[model samples]
Target chain A: MTGRVPEGLRELLAQAAGEGHAPWRTLLKAGDWALLLMAALLVAASYPLLWRGGVADRAIVKRDGQLVTELALNTPRKYEVVGAIGTTVIEVQPGRARVLSDPGPRQYCVQQGWLTRANAVAICAPNHVTLQLSGRSGQNGAYDTLNY
Target chain B: MAPMTPSTIELPVTADDYRIARYAAAAIALTVAETALPSPLPGIKPGLANIIVLVVLARYGWRDAAWVSLLRVVAGSLVIGQFLAPGFFLALAGALCSLAVLALAQYLPPRFFGPVSASVLAAFAHIGGQIVLARLWLVPHDGVFYLLPLFATAALVFGAINGLVAARLLDLPAVAPAEAAA
Candidate 1:
């Protein structure tokens, strides 16, 4: 037996049942509206966190996992660091740094493009050298470091 | 014909048992199949098996749905040879969180709350649980949170699709027992 359902709701349900349509599509209940709003809000709130970008002021270079050099990013210059495998050329431009050349066969380090953000890093595994950017204003406003 | 006696009779299986078994098997199959596909990112999958769980939850209630989901995770992991592994634990965590969310979401008025909303909430909860567990046990680093945005986006997209699929399936008339037997 049908309970004391509203006429409008009963008719909508009947139509949905007859046509094999999802009833929620036709008439959204208050709960569904609330959930939809919440989902939208969540997506909007996370956009800034994911896409935050800032300029870096310091560039740190490491060789064989040891700190070898640290440079101020304010000056534009190209420098080279010799590692066990070969030499790695680093290019610094204002607030960004990148690998101009690397001895690795694949040149993956050169392919890393640039490191302008505070936590950005580039590595030449074959030459055993790494370049990372950091600065007081470079932080993404998130966690300090990532494990995985 | 000889008259049948109580001693010669066999107990008939309940309809609920049959339905549960069918849905659980489907879920398990989906889970195993999903593992074979290559994923672009770690700990991310379409989670298509969740559609079955949602349908069961809508039709049979949360307890039966939970049973189906638990069976799927256990049997599916065993079939894929990932039982007791880190991957298995992550999957289990996601499933438990999703089920818990579904259970709570069911309290909303039926008119406004349906498979889509439930699926979305469940998906987010699933990801949240996995990330928390990963931080505590797997990665143990703050960096894991960096992947949250990617995981959250995946959940939103997949959750909406799965919810729609579940909604379509739920709209169908119940299968006749005679047809099911065939």
Candidate 2:
């Protein structure tokens, strides 16, 4: 491997390890900033969930590794649940829901209460289980093509 | 097709000329690195060429810096066949936001912050701009919070990497300068 590295090897090395830069786009003009801003603003405006109702995919409920059959989203608007193990109804408040567990006083789940559609979450930290209400990805025109 | 020389006719530069040739070479190299690098998923690149941009910005003015960024976006996008896709838009937004940050960083005296801080600041702004764009013309989701932590983590990691590269590039011998002077 003196001065002349094999011609093919040298060519390969040059192509593979060469430095790079780019060309000019002397034509790109900044015109769509305002429209993009407006669209973002529109989405941000609906954040309070006062006017537009959120539709999360089916909410599943379980207790102690067993499906809680009784508790179900019976109707589009109605909701109810029941459990046999360590389950107790704390209370339901407007714009929120809650549950009380005998696990500990820290009660991170209870403190994380009254979550609306925008802030959909579930915490059964003690049972090592969680249920999350996901917003519609299929219904909205947000997607052009499914990854599948 | 023969590779064209730099745009300026007034200053003719050959392939052997260190200045123009080196920039052209760096552009192609960065473009390949950006497109070929695997990400967590497809259409996801870390904008790694930003290190080169920060270096160019330091050595040259805003104009050349902008050109390098523009070239990377265009040539890189074309090379990867994502020129007109949504991915292109994301890269374009990142480039523009970076240019904005680099231009702003110019005002401050080269004191406490260097390329790393500049790159990090630009990365933060880059994410913000992309999120804003995605929420608007692209997909809509209440899942922004779900992605916030992930993007934030990525920024911290990638931003440091960019800053490090920028610093490294700054130290490398300037083998070539850019043509069209931008």
Candidate 3:
């Protein structure tokens, strides 16, 4: 490999060896630091956009793409939703709603644990049942139910 | 006596080809070795292979560095059995973007731009390219972009480290003697 060193690169290498600390001088500049700081700032800015807000005060239950019922999150209650597959039991608390039980292979809806934010949702796809949260922000219609 | 004609044409191998091959092999070795190490994050790796690319870029030039990097990506993916896989595409995208960034960085005033800055710029470009490709083809979710902060931070730290290593290597007197002898 050493035997094949090109003429141009050989000269460059000699210059590098002669300069000693020259490479270090070129490694980091003020502009590079500025770029690094900008990247950090960009990351900081994304925090709010990526943040998930707190739970909302209302819940909407939909069965087979149609509105089934609306529940006041403050009022704790349980509702039984019947679908083609089987019944799904939905429970609503002061600020959260979740699937207590659902007939599905994986019970993914129950696994979702809870939905307490304006756009949070729990769906029992096997039974075609969905429980979505909506409140003050009126961002209820912001995203499609599919996003859940 | 009839003049003897050469039986076969022998193409001379250029010095550039030998150099690129050596650097590419080193980069590939580093990449394969890195795969064996456990990573806490999906996209984060120490990126040790990047040091070779940085060294080649600083010592040789952008063109040689590009050749070395592209060869490493292709050869590395082949060795790891990621050829034509989503991983291969992602790697290719990252390599291309990083090379472009390195080329652009070369134009900066020499006093303010060196291996460290070039490495950092390339690292960011590499990660950015991979994330964009992943979001477009692999995951297709906004969730992927959320990982940018983690990836960017890793790129900065690793890039700076790799740059330092490259700069130190470039400054070595031993390397010059061998090239000078050639």
Candidate 4:
């Protein structure tokens, strides 16, 4: 509470401060180098995959914090998500998605977009419709189902 | 430079050596805390140890924090088997975002903000980074609608804890008595 020393906290502080230069400068240099290396590694990893196509991931649908029962769509068609007891219908169109639900206090889901790619999701808190996305590129039946 | 080798005075690390042990310690603590912290919702953790990373940034330097984070992410992920999971990527994005926040917070005199503020900023940046990365790699199409209140909540709680720890780290005596007297 008192911004200054408070004994117990001070003792622990003594523990971390430890001894020497505090390695502040060394840490900066190391972090930048590491991030650069990591970015390079990621891009490098993606490069091999990119020449072929793209990475695919799994997408799922959730309603009211629970997984949704059904969702199916490709590039052109729209996937509809309806909550068990809610009036919300989440529509997923190509490149983008939208929600059609009775307006409530939080209109967050209505302003959200479509779920096309892997790991994409749309949640209408009040309406209780949640759309999740998933896929991994260059696979047999690139489009997968949760049942699978 | 070689490690201090426990020479009667300096600690195990070298004078020029910059790998802040706190970063390593924090990563370990965070990884443990992340795993140990009870969660009703799976795969959602605030990464409490990031406070250590934030403190390292303020007390030592960004380079140290960055190195610590890189190692922590890679090491922590490997330990948890999340090295390449979508969630792992989110954590990576968060680490990168925190780095940016640390740089900006550098100007806000230590007395005013300290590690907690920097960490909170990092937590927000980390979440932003995760959202952007997730949208790019995992869920590109539905990126826009992912926004919600939980993101803010996660940032606030995680940031406050990280800051408090960092403040404690900075307040300690710079040198031990015998070593200083020598």
| Consecutive 10-residue window with the lowest summed lDDT within model 1 chain A | A4-13
Q: Candidate 2: which docking quality band?
A: incorrect
Candidate order by DockQ, highest to lowest? 3, 1, 4, 2
Query: Best candidate, TM-score-wise?
Result: 3
Candidate 3, residue B150: Cα displacement in angstroms equals 1.3
Instruction: Report the lDDT tens digits of candidate 2 across residue range A1-148.
Output: 5343432223324443446522111111122223223434544554433234344433434455555532222132333334333443433332233443424346665566544452254566564433333334435423232111
What order do you get sorting by lDDT, best first? Answer: 1, 3, 4, 2
Off by over 4 Å in 2: A1-148, B1-25, B41-44, B172-182
Per-candidate DockQ values are 0.12, 0.04, 0.17, 0.05
What are the RMSDs of all candidates, in order?
13.0, 15.2, 11.1, 16.4
Model 3: CA > 4 A from native: A1-27, A52-148, B1-9, B174-178
| True-structure lDDT of candidate 3 | 0.77
Residues A1-148, candidate 3, lDDT per residue (tens digit)?
7655543344444554564365454556676677667766776776655544433667888999999998877767999999879999999876678999999989888988877566678888999998887855665344444234
Q: What's the distance in Å from true for residue B108, model 1?
A: 0.8
Count clashing pairs, candidate 1. 2
Q: lDDT tens string, model 1, B45-94?
A: 99988988987888779998998899888988999999999988998999
